[model samples]
Target: MSKDAPPHISGTPESSAKARARKLRMPPLRRRRLEFDDVNVVDKAMMKKAVGGTVVGNTMEWFDVGVYGYLAVTMGAVFLSDADKDAQLLFSLGVFAATFIARPLGGVVFGRLGDRIGRQKTLAITLIMMAASTFIIGLLPSYDTIGIWAPILLVLMKLLQGFSTGGEYAGATTFVSEYASDKRRGFLASILDLGSYMGFALGAAVVSVMQLLLSESDMVGWGWRIPFLIAGPLGAFAIYFRLKIEESPAFQATLDAQEASAKAGDETESLGTMGIFRAYWRPIVLAMVLVAAVNSVGYALTSYMPSYLTDSKGYDPVHGTLLTIPVLVVMALCIPLAGKLSDRIGRRPVLWIGAGSTIVLAVPAFMLIGQGPVATTLLGLLLLAVPVTFYVGNLAATLPSLFQTSSRYGAMGISYNVATAVFGGTAPLIMQGLIALTDNDMSPAYWLMFTSVAGAIAVIFMKESAQRPMPGSMPSVDTEAEAYELVAGQDENPNLDVDSLPFDTLGSQQGTQSDADPAPAGTADHR
Candidate 1:
């Protein structure tokens, strides 16, 4: 039979007539049609639940981190000794940076679990641990009450938060990405970061309110603890949402495939860090660079802004915190829009907009910020926020697209965490040190410029991934071309069940003619 021929009409003429009669008795297929449609083959309602579950954990983690950044000076006073104010602030931020130190470790541990077991379970564990740690920080005694142990406890709690978050941010992004259709992945995945920004914005709002309402002494004595304490309740709420959501069907399909292989006594393949690293080194390097650039700017904008305004621009800490609110709100709004735009135009274009715009505007924006008027500062900050939003908004969909399902969680977590630890987590401390050394108020701009350039270079190298189908199994080294070819090869083999399709289809270089092949029974789209 020709390849284009209709599927074999196997029934004999008499059986066909009987089947026609049965069809007339059955309900029409059109009656079951649903209005929602997207690339991922999931319904709209399920996708929303997935996004909600993923976003809550992200919000809680970032919220705690933002609270710490907003109250760094107060934390310094409470945790550090009766030393120089600058020294105390430095010590406090140093401890803040300590969290990044634990992230890479968390990435390895949690990423492994996510890849090996499942994304949902790993996220649940990390969220609980991170929230618990943040709550503990609020309960610790100050240096005046507990001596050096207070600072030591603070350091420990921060480290725990960092470690837990190591798994969280990346894991949440991966979870949402897997659930989203390729066409809508950018918009859906962007919600993960929107949750994060919202978390940070809410944290900043709380701190700003406290600073505005309370006396200086009251803020110093007790107001600093409120935000940290709030993490507990927020965490409980996040956990509830996470539990209500279902596992990634993509991951579950992988498991089903593995079980079938075992039952048939066929050898089932497993992915490891070394194997994944060897296959995906190019994307890994590019992802690290991309993440580093975006994160440096992100931390600079959110975590470092309050300190930068108060210390360098001579604004009140409360006013500095207040300024961040508008910036984060702009980011939160921009994230989903950027995601949808990327879906329309493509991920690479959005990334280019982010990197190129940041490179052009970073220096000028910082100059305006240093000018110190509310109007100029807001304008400068808004200029910077625009590019960063484009970058971050598209990141979840873009980054996870680089790897196959088997290796995606681990690859994303490790590379992203490494870059974040090196750049994003340290932006504020670096900015503080640079200003002190050079007395150049524009030092932060220089760092932003450097990272933005790196991001641009990475963007220039990234493969366009809009509407690209995810690999059903582990893809080969050339993920952009190989994944589609793999799917095509699977279509040519009639005996290979959908779950039995090899994760990596070697030696096939055919065009995507096989894309027309229908998915095997009980299988969803896999990439």
Candidate 2:
């Protein structure tokens, strides 16, 4: 045989075929070049308005949640006056869990609507529904007045609130994330949760004051209605802000691209519920796991802690509710700091800190709470807050990054609410049940530890998205100069992976460039 001739492989037919296959394989797709014009220049003023609007709505939603949570015992007594104390407490918590039952359905309906209509409009609708339902709950007739119908009406209103709330957080996060510049996304998005816990703290404070001032009969007879009634004005205020805001720029861009694609006769696949599931089930599942972990700790602190303190730890209703107020306020204040830290280091590292801290602090936090002094209880709550700060702070930024701009709202609605329904909303009841079943007060801690372990594992699989462009969108920067700088340093910027970006989805731009295209002047192709 001539020297140039191919030599025969000394292996079975399968090995020979495999060798041939390797030789014939296509080369990897080349990284796309980014031009200065390709970078999106964020409107700072508009971004701030968008963030404010979204945050206010989030705050209102959580305020309603906080009112319900802090008033769990009182609500039970008012609605189930015939039941034993334990039964009434259980009944109230059961009603609270019922709110989450409607979340998944709300998530699907509003999520798709947000994706279809616009984030701003859908958000306004959800806020109206949430506020109205909460206000109506305040006007609901008590068991004494209406007999069985009172609890039924109460549950119906809570379910309505749950339905609206299903859309609130997911839409808020998506709205802020899309509006924010990539560099400041973490810190900006974190502000939503800052509003969230602050709302919770406000609710606790209001309830605590009412408890101090009102007689027990007064609270049960009339005072409990005040907080829920307050939702009417707050919801109106949030709705006004939401209505004033425009659709998110990223989502608008996606819509524009879709329109352009249709005009040019390009086929664009619609990502409905099943389509989203089929296309992005992996990330959806991963996000659910992460949601489950963080919310377990979050709900345990915010929702369950008051009950745990009052019922199990032997604190009065007033002290139990008041004890968490300071801790929540402090933790809420620190959430943005953790978000900023995630921006500097990376999402995964900060998430690792959150997960690891939950594992380490869960048992100790419960132990300190069990000690029964104000200082020890505060310290325990603070320990629980540590992991919550790291975890919840970054979620608004991290979860949205998992999916593309086109389906992010829908995907988030499904993933977040489902996990919340199962783990988050049920956390209070579950902990209560766990303690009863095991006859061990530490059962809640063990549950938290288990969830954190799962969270840690999920973190390993999550893509590091800090300081990176969201999928299906252009690189977003705060200013024209920043856009130019990003393009100039594209090759050297580790976080900006041009190859991974879905440039094909950028509509008309897809046909304008190819692998052979050279980098724009002043930019180097180092990949």
Report the C-alpha lDDT of model 2 over 1-527, residue by residue, as the tens digit.
Answer: 34444545345566688788887896876767888767778777888899898889899999999999999999999999999999999999999999999999999999999988989999999999999999999999999999999999999999999999999999999999888888888999999999999999999999999999998899999999999999989888988888889888778877777677789997466677877776677888999999999999999999999999999989999999999999999999999999999999988999999999999999999999999999999999999999999999899999988877777789889999999999999999999999999999999999999999999999898878899887666678887888778889988998888765556656323211111111222231221
- lDDT tens readout by residue for model 1, 1-527: 34454433544565567778888999765411111111124545767798988888888889999999999888898887577789888998898899999998899889889988899999999999999999999999989898999999999999999999999987888888777765577998999899899999999999999999998788879888898999889999999998887777556655555566578787456656666666667788999999989998888899998888887788888998999899899889889999999989989899989988888899989988988789999999898898889999999998887766766788788899999999988889998999999999888888888988889988888877776555442222123343344346644633224443332322112211011112222232323
The most accurate candidate by lDDT is 2
**Candidate 2 backbone overlaps, count:** 0
Q: After aligning candidate 1 to the native by TM-score, how far in Å is the CA of 461 from where it should be?
A: 1.9
Candidate 2 local Cα displacement, residue 264, angstroms: 2.3
Model 1 misplaced regions, further than 4 Å: 1-40, 473-527
Evaluate residue 76 in candidate 2 and report its C-alpha lDDT on the 0 to 100 scale.
94
TM-score of each: 0.83, 0.90
lDDT of 1: 0.79
lDDT scores for all predictions? 0.79, 0.88
Cand. 2 Cα-lDDT = 0.88
